[model samples]
Target: MMVQCVICDILEELDNTAPEAKRLRNRPIHTYMCAACHERVTARTNERIATGKFRFYRSSRRIEGDFYS
Candidate 1:
């Protein structure tokens, strides 16, 4: 199956029987990211987290309650 990376727009080929291919075929909302783009994003996110000022604005309500407790 042919899939395009949502981040880099690069085209990649996956085996027809691959689980990822099946997932993309069955679920339209899921997105694909190339390995390089994924790694880059991961590294940048870690950097931000290490800066001690990163905030997760979308944190769960349960976590917010726990924080105030």
Candidate 2:
């Protein structure tokens, strides 16, 4: 399967049988990130974490539950 990196927009070919390729085929909202960009971002994020200033925000499942209740 042919996929493009969401960060760098580089075209890459993936094995059609690979799980990632299947995921992209099945989900339109899921994006593909090339290995290079993935590594770069990981390194940068690690650096920020080491500096003690990185913040990771996650959606609150508790808030959603409360809203439905």
The candidate scoring highest on lDDT is 1
Question: Model 2, 47: alpha-carbon shift in Å?
Answer: 0.4
C-alpha lDDT values of all predictions = 0.86, 0.86
Q: Give per-model TM-scores.
A: 0.75, 0.80
Instruction: Put down candidate 1 lDDT per residue, 2-59, tens digits, no spaces.
Output: 8899988999999999898889999999998889999999989879877968767899
Model 2, backbone clash pairs (residues 3+ apart or across chains), number: 0
What is the alpha-carbon lDDT for the whole of candidate 2?
0.86
Residue-level lDDT for 9 in candidate 1: 99
RMSD in Å for all candidates = 4.3, 6.8
- Give lDDT tens digits, candidate 2, residues 1-69: 889999999999999999999999999999999999999998887788679675545648776456435
Give me the displacement of residue 9 in model 1, in angstroms. Answer: 0.9
Question: Which consecutive 10 residues in model 1 have the weakest lDDT in total?
Answer: 60-69
